[model samples]
Target: MSCLEIMPKLGLTMTEGMLAKWHKSEGEKIEKGEILFEVETDKLTNEIEAKESGVVRKILVEEGETVKCLAPVAVIAGENEDISGLLKEAGVNGQEVAETKTEEKKSDNTAVEAGPKKVVVIGGGPGGYIAAIRAAQLGNKVTLIEKEELGGTCLNVGCIPTKTLLHSAELFSEIKDSRNLGIDVGEVSINWKNVQRRRKRVIKKLVSGVKGLLSYNKVNVINGFARMETENSLTVSKEGGKSEKIDFDSAIISTGSVPFAPLIPGIGLEGVIDSTGALELESLPETIVIIGGGVIGIEFASLFSSLGKKVTILEMLPFILPPIDRQISSMIADKLSKQGVSINTGCRVTSIEKGENGLKVDFTKGNDNLNVEAEKVLVAIGRRSNTEGLELEKIGVKTEKGRVCVDDYMRTNAGSIYAIGDCTGKIMLAHVASEQGVVAAENISGKNVKMDYKTVPSCVYTKPEIASTGLTEEQVKEKGIDYKVGIFPMGANGKAMISKEPDGIIKIIADKKTEEILGVHIMAPRATDLIGEAALALRLEATVDEVVTTIHAHPTINEAFKEAALAVQKRALNSVN
Candidate 1:
């Protein structure tokens, strides 16, 4: 039988890569260790070498096209050997390859759905809009309703806006330290107005993009608040006393979330603002006190501190980023402290009061009562699911602690009703919601799709960004799994040293008995982008040896991930074992 040559995983985090060039054509003889093709990822391009000596039977994947990691890109065999089965297995028919699995599922679903369904999705956020589009693509008549802006909180006031500001903050912080990199640029200053303007521009562009996508998908979008009267019927009320009734065979609720405001005294004061208000600040404060030490709070702390604003964070939890791996969280805390951000954990905010300087934040740490004065106080405590006016109860849809309840398929208790995203309160990240939306839409389209949270990646957009996927060390211990850990410091990475960003580490944890990779945590430059590969690893149940054998491009930050995997077996080449 002819052997298949697949697109090799070039790095630990790489799920797919672009076929940049082909060194060998069909029928060309190639030897082991000879360059076969070049693959390009966001990090770097690497020439992939052949593993077995053979004549290239057929080039399955063309250059400039992207192929998934481990998917057959070409078939290699000896002269006169039959390779028809290999090409068919690679989804090659003549010169055309198969469409994506999602598209294939849609085609199957279209065949299953003898008639189009009137699918209604409430709220135009990441979850709602995605579900609406997917439902439409699955040959359904889909309608989406939202009172505020399209793209919901994430695009309007959450992820997009916050990341935009953080990018500016990171730029300013980097330029200030650029002299150390032999770039002697003097007089670094932040133009706050321009920063805010750019943030708005980015948000506007994203919101417009979402609108365009909805239109292209043929999803009917309504600008109003949706209230469910029955499982199959709802009413949408618009501004200026306009109302319309919508009847559908199926419905998806994706109302998203709102920032939770604790009942601390003076929380409603002028200077005390929630995350939404913080994003809309007219001017940057000289000093800011952010209450909460979760992802949102830590990101804002990074933003303000990087811009030379005095930043203080108070958290009721014993530690910051409690959901993250303890070691990674501790490292981030240390870095934030070094950057002059004061993080006070295991503290409860008593009150916010007006003071001589700007605003006084009073909190207690154990037996000590402490106060910090700042120009503005931001409440980043957390968010609660936004199910207001949804009237899910009217339709007998169950809700737990103000969040919609749903099954793995995102179906609600009420017949033909589904819920996704923050409204369900199952992992509040936008990406999670989007996936849940897909699950809900596909299920509604007569497909058996379920949402999986096992490999969801959590990201923190701070200096030396943090991202993690799969079980944490604590969770693994609680589950009583015997696991081995590997750690690689960025100080030893060539790219980190060249970029002067050698202040993070990549950690990998795998099952000792089976060598299955259980978790991957990273706090390095481009860590957010790097987590995708880790997520794919977890999804595919990749083993430590699998990661170690993957060829990582030299002189790149991604090589640290491979080194970390090697460390799992005490055999890391570039770092101390």
Candidate 2:
């Protein structure tokens, strides 16, 4: 008798999982407890072990294919056993599903319905899902297509997860010093597993809310890999079923970015992982060596260091937070150094090697060759736009440097097709992507809108969060703009001082002639939340005098903003100018 293996439910809330990789080849001898495959669910990869010993007969699901729970994905049987009937019963020929995925191009000749436009959005990230909801709100029939989980990278592996963990770390740090505030506290240690469990719960709640929104807005969601069959048509492939053809009057490609991996030796080694892997690690390694000192690495450094983990950051550049203002970047590096984070900027890593302890990283700075060893290595260089499976080139959708090319209105070369979010490589932030999604959806619904990049804010959620909007001082200098700089330390703010979180500074740049706010950069607590004011000021083209005269409430962190604005004209009250 043959044994059928289906996609098992890994969690109560997981309706489906992506077969990330098969650990064993077809026809390979199987062991009862040996690893068989990996299933990605809840943003974590879980190894699915073989339940019974048998020769593998067939693998029905392909890698990257998403399969629903309880769906037969493979078959194993005793040698010489009749498996044909079982295969027939399971409806998994493998070849049949493969054939359906390679079907011919679908023509965009569907009869137009008089009621509403038919819209299909691929990739349910912050961008894609938001676009679907907006389109539906505009009286369009919307279908959202996602290969794996919704909420995309931001909710799963990127923004939400990082911030959640950071909050935990911050709370732990706060408790360690509670006695200083005259509060009696006993020993408190992080229940790491509980922290992990809570992170998962938060994510599940938010994802369910997003899905609920989609349902309420009347957006039909297809869970499968989508490939473009035509400008107005797509072929979605499921793990254990025939391909589905979806046609629309318009489409959106929000398929976001994947971690940019360099071709260095030993990068594929056992303990070397990417940003997503770092987020899902079950336990803290004794020490971690992170490559690249960009926003991702810096945030991770903040996270592990707060928990008293040994962390070393290696960067090829001259400084960390490369895009930030030079002086503020230097300040952040110093603060992180004070936190015991070993930062080696201008250190070019030539290769990573497996070491006796864990992993060895070899690099050189100028004439010096150096190395560091740690329990794990994280490659956090950056991200690249995901555009492979969409088949953009086949339909004349233009792309530059592997990113989908779109105009100000998010329209691709094909007028009926559009792309947004990380895939377009426009500002690779979730908020930016969400705004772009709105712009794209509005344009599709017969509204004219263009994305304004000038006021878009970028934030880093490290200890003493960093944020910026508009032109940096260096950029203004390069543009030959006449600018005046105002600076105020957070320690000068009464509210910040009282809260015991007074570390870092605020720097504002204003045009000397126009007195208009050219930029606002901060390295202070809750900078991510505070940057919204700067974004709005830039959007409204507000001037220094306007902010200074706004009469900020007393003993509030926001008063620092007005003080910094006053410093632009050398009239600061609470702080010396």
Candidate 3:
């Protein structure tokens, strides 16, 4: 049986639409959800997707022709099947053929003749695997090489694993305060074994899913360490010491970064560990001293403090989370301090020594010297690109301070070579790496795409989660822009009061002259999820008035965002303005 492809009524007042283009010709195969034709109405143009998978048996409407709503535009059925009755129902007199359109949808990438090109990607992290799958989609024979797990550090030991632990810690914290909500539960305690088990389970499931996607995309995944041997070829050394060589038309390097441990006296002591080691610890420590107060440091502090562990953080900078908005960071610092987490800024670690109880860390704050002893000492300063074994210099891929140098197109100095992710030393966030991967794959397939960083949102998963996008107040001031700020404390939000989490705020900064939203910062429940809306506002260059005019649902946290936008004009409705 055949189904009639009707001209859909796209808008409330739309009765007829012009068939601008037909993506599939008669007798051509089309999958469900694939674009079948383009429809242009008086209001807007839309790509109409196929409702069912089959061959286009007959087309009743030609390109640039107008058809009314519910009119049959085409007939879809099995290949070589009879569709004469359906065509007649469409009022197409006995086997009349419609002229096919030659126009096709344009891609963001530079259009080149589609052909089978062999593409090799080194590393299977977020960037490398994404590039491999995308390249394969663009008619390329893609081969991905990974020495370890398929999902790279993020899935194996970094983002997924750490967030899993944080979720468990957060749940424990919530349960401890459940009595305030009229829920009296038994005494709450941390299940270290269960937490670690869940973390491993989530990582395994995600890694397996990545492997399945690669197989589905027809990408050849090689389990081995890859090294560049020539400009066009590389050698892979497998676990059994067998080496195989591969040649490619294009190559992408996304071998990510590793934890960096600072050099200090007795730094190699027994209790000192990096972020990876900290995640895999057998048992939770009674007291832990974490060096560095960056994102990783602060997150770990939140986790430990919530779990009733004595935690201390030492930072060489005057403030923690130096990259984000200082106001948001300061609020998190204050919250952690109230939770009994010691945060010592402007402290320089001098040495680490083993004491009778555990390990002793000596540091200096200004002219004062101090020491803190804990069962475990974690070095969470930062990470550095892992380019040691790639032999990038052999291929003349330029490197500056141990990071691959790439242009806006994610192309390296060497021809046919590209780099992304932590190796490129760009944003270093997982999402940034994934976007760069797509950009590189598109450029390789002859699409002209450039990496844009203007709207990248940063998130920290501490309690009352922090997230921000665009410029901070300090950045705006440095640029000498006249700006206005709108801040709505979560205390004034009904949802916050109902949830007993009213200690955070949402702040939006806008240009004073035009009221264009310049930046958005949030330190509230689910701030990471909320920042996406702000990021889109910045991306579209939307003004505060637009946000204020948009009717937000009542008694929700999102209403607080709208309230903040209103506050920009000194017209907040829910609070005193």
Q: Evaluated with TM-score, which candidate comes out highest?
A: 3
Clashing pairs in 1: 13-533
By summed lDDT, the worst window of 10 consecutive residues in model 3 runs over 96-105
The reply for model 2, stretches above 4 Å from the true place, is: 1-115
Reference-based lDDT, each prediction:
0.88, 0.87, 0.88
Q: Against the hidden true structure, what lDDT does model 2 obtain?
A: 0.87
lDDT of 1 by residue, 422-459 (tens): 98888999999998998788677655566778999999
Q: Regarding lDDT, does 1 or 2 come out ahead?
A: 1
* TM-score for each model: 0.82, 0.80, 0.85
Off by over 4 Å in 1: 1-114
- Which residue pairs collide in model 3, if any? 109-447, 109-448, 110-446, 110-447, 110-448
Evaluate model 3: give its TM-score.
0.85
Q: lDDT score, residue 285, model 1? A: 94
- After the best TM-score superposition of candidate 3, give how far the Cα of residue 122 lies from its true spot, in angstroms: 0.9
Give RMSD to native, each candidate. Answer: 9.5, 19.8, 6.7
State the displacement of the C-alpha of residue 168, model 2, in Å, after optimal TM-score superposition.
0.2
lDDT of 2 by residue, 396-508 (tens): 89999889999888988797898999999978999889989987886776544578899888898887889999889999999999999999889998888777878888889
